[model samples]
Target: MGAVASQDKQATLKGSEPSVAPLMRLVEPGMARVNALILEMAGSHAKMIPDIARHLIDSGGKRLRPMLTLACAEACGYSGENHVKLAAAVEFMHTATLLHDDVVDESELRRGKPSARMLWGNQASVLVGDYLLGQAFQTMVQVGSLDALAVLSKAASVIAEGEVLQLVAAKNLATGEEQYLKVINAKTAALFSAATEVGPIIAQSTADMRRAMAEYGTQLGLAFQLVDDALDYGGSSMTLGKKVGDDFREGKVTLPIVLAARAGTTEDRTFWSRTIEHGEINDGDLERAIDILRKQGAIAATVERARSYGDKAIAALAALPAGAHRDALEEVVLYCISRVS
Candidate 1:
């Protein structure tokens, strides 16, 4: 998640395109099982739950997190079928979070389509999210590993805590890089770490190896989120799945803005205060913000930061066994950081 792959399929950058197919290739069979299980478990008596859940589920995503579970288990030499259940559980947890997050962020679009809250009401989205959470736990229980269950449960709690923390920090320009990192670490990295950790926990691998896998996922997650933050301002709506500048419009104080604010002149600080702190955005504010970020090298710096975490992720993989799965995992970190390129 070891050394960055030198000759893998994902070694070359493709502008804003993320390289996930190699990882997908390595775990295609397992991912198929996870997908089938997801569809089966999404069923409900009410029908609405499946409808709303599938709306986003069917939308194209790389399913990177679930792949990590499957690949990590394979990396740990797990021959059992329990990883399929764990992988599906990871995806359910992710989809549930997306549904709840869209409601909380008041987002209208997700994965290039109408958000669940846009078609269904906020109540429906919230209820469907709860339904998915129940399904996730049910699948986790099916895995029958108490340690895996414990890790996932803690991740669920930490994800909620991260969301609450972000809400508290919203529109607060005083929030610094450290505070923002804490938010993403809990919100995003916790699940990622748990996803990989459960694989070793199920495989009954050494404690050192399990910890290494967890750290690998944690660093990869941090790199992934930082790149996403950069893309929100710099990438297109087609690539980002939502409108560009959504964070700015919503007054989310991300890393780029944090860097710019710290490096900007007094006039730039005033602009930041008006747009991000007070929500007094105007027509050209987004453009101005982008220009300021460019001039201040905020975006470039954020990409550099992501690369650092990607390197750390690769280093963490050193403790895992060497094989195609391990190599694919290393390429994943490279691909994540490449999204910002």
Candidate 2:
């Protein structure tokens, strides 16, 4: 994208949407510690382990997952340093997932750069991912919070299961919104819930507080993923960090495609089958797909669904203590939805 176009998009993002800068500033100190710990933990005797790990970690991701952990802990009045360790662990887990996901999707780009798999080969990517997971577990063990460990461990398992579920659902026109929601809940929301919940767990907060954070994370994650799904089809590639229509090219049955397929006519369904299910794409297939999504109002419906989840996320914050952290967290949800809006 051109500088002028990027500037206009930034202006649009600043006008009505809540920026994440508040949240980033709120957790900056904890994030500094978390960043150092992440680098320390990612180290290994083998040169390739750090090499591959640093490649993706240094890539320009927002590091939102770990920041959630830090923010939640601070919001709950946590004083100890365990939250820092937990935040680093959250980042490691997220990085590992991205490594595995790139390999599975056979993706060439991540965050608008060549993916780790693309540079290091699939075998190296998978192995480095495994190494990171092991490091994450070790860091979690050091925290000495069994409950926090349990939450993250369960999330790891659910994320793996979600990936498998998505693999099964890919290219299947029969996939519905319900199943698609389930996939995102496991794949994306599980980690978010875990990342946020660990904050209250380590803070020794009340059950109500824990539940609130978990709900907030889950709803926020759903909203984030739904917005991402919509952006894949309707937004700019520069905003997405990956090429537009990647979901369509991979035949991933995201909510937008599910809604579009449901609202489409017989010929529309046939077109989806030919291009998405069968992968027999032609020169203008992507443009035609966008036309169909627009005609069926699938993109709008998906954004509405994301807005509903964003509202739920804000509601979930009612139980948390009121402060800058809480406000930042709420804004984070709005920020997620506003990318497409």
Candidate 3:
């Protein structure tokens, strides 16, 4: 397929996302000049943490959150070292959440490696996640931006709320769009929204501009997650670095499945409602769900929803003046929706 058509046919990421292999191309020195800061953050008390923390820390994620902060700051015309600290803080917070989530979900894997909870035991994993969160707050203090700190705190609180919401509403089978939105906003979008807004907050941008960044982040976060939900069914386990159909096994009630369950034929409904919805999913259940999702058009519908968010992200960026940084940000929107590897 041609590049544009290939992107257009991505699993559920029906819009633009920077491709994984070439994300560095979208990021310039402006986005990448903070690796040392991250190393320093991890260096403070190295030996105390041990291999578990080291394992997760070494996984080499795409670092999308930090990149958002850097690119947004540059786009908004901020030039300083503070964004580095902020980016590191966001990463720590995100990584911390992943640890806690693995423990809570009893997940065995992360980023294609043994989860912290798996390798180090649940107690160690939970404590380390806590440590990362505390360390994140400490970094915030060092930056000396109370406003930024407030943003981080709010984001953290929202994330916690989202997790709680998901747990409370996990398998109702009637999780409406509103409830799902709440879960998604808390679980994923909160940080994306916060990271993007951090740039404006750090630069002391005008209120309107700050809101624009927040909108952009919120839309991107939603799009990112919608694609993630789609990937749960269609994406490869190797590419995602976690188990395929993990959400189904966990009974997470993501959007595609939600729509699929509703649209299923009576027999299809019987199996999914009794087995998958109850988290009793077994052999071939995933294959069955994929078949139902395809038949019901749930997968494509979910991808369309993701594309809407991508469009909204681009619309949010329209207010910003044109520049390489802005163009890079726009490309990121496309790439997020297109990424498979």
Q: Residue 290, candidate 3: how far off, in angstroms? A: 0.6
Residue-level lDDT of model 2, residues 1-341, one tens digit each, is: 22233234435544755689999999998899998999899888999999988888888889999999999998998988999999999989999999999999999889888998888899999999999999999999999999999999999999999999999999998999999999999999999999999999999999999999999999989988999999998998778878899999999999988998888999999999998899999999999999999888999999888888888888888888788898788778767877996
lDDT of 2 at 163: 100
True lDDT of residue 6, candidate 1: 27
Stretches of candidate 3 off by over 4 Å are 1-33, 44-50
Query: Could you tell me the C-alpha RMSD of candidate 1 in Å?
Result: 2.6
Ranked by TM-score, the better of candidates 2 and 3 is 2
Identify the leading candidate in terms of lDDT.
Answer: 2
What TM-score does candidate 1 reach?
0.95
C-alpha positional error of residue 242 in candidate 1 after TM-score superposition, expressed in Å: 1.3
lDDT (CA) for every model shown?
0.89, 0.90, 0.80
lDDT of 3: 0.80
User: Model 3 over residues 55-99: C-alpha lDDT tens digits?
Assistant: 876786778888898778767878898888898899889988999
Candidate 2 residue 58 C-alpha distance from true site, Å: 1.4
Q: Rank the candidates by lDDT, best first.
A: 2, 1, 3
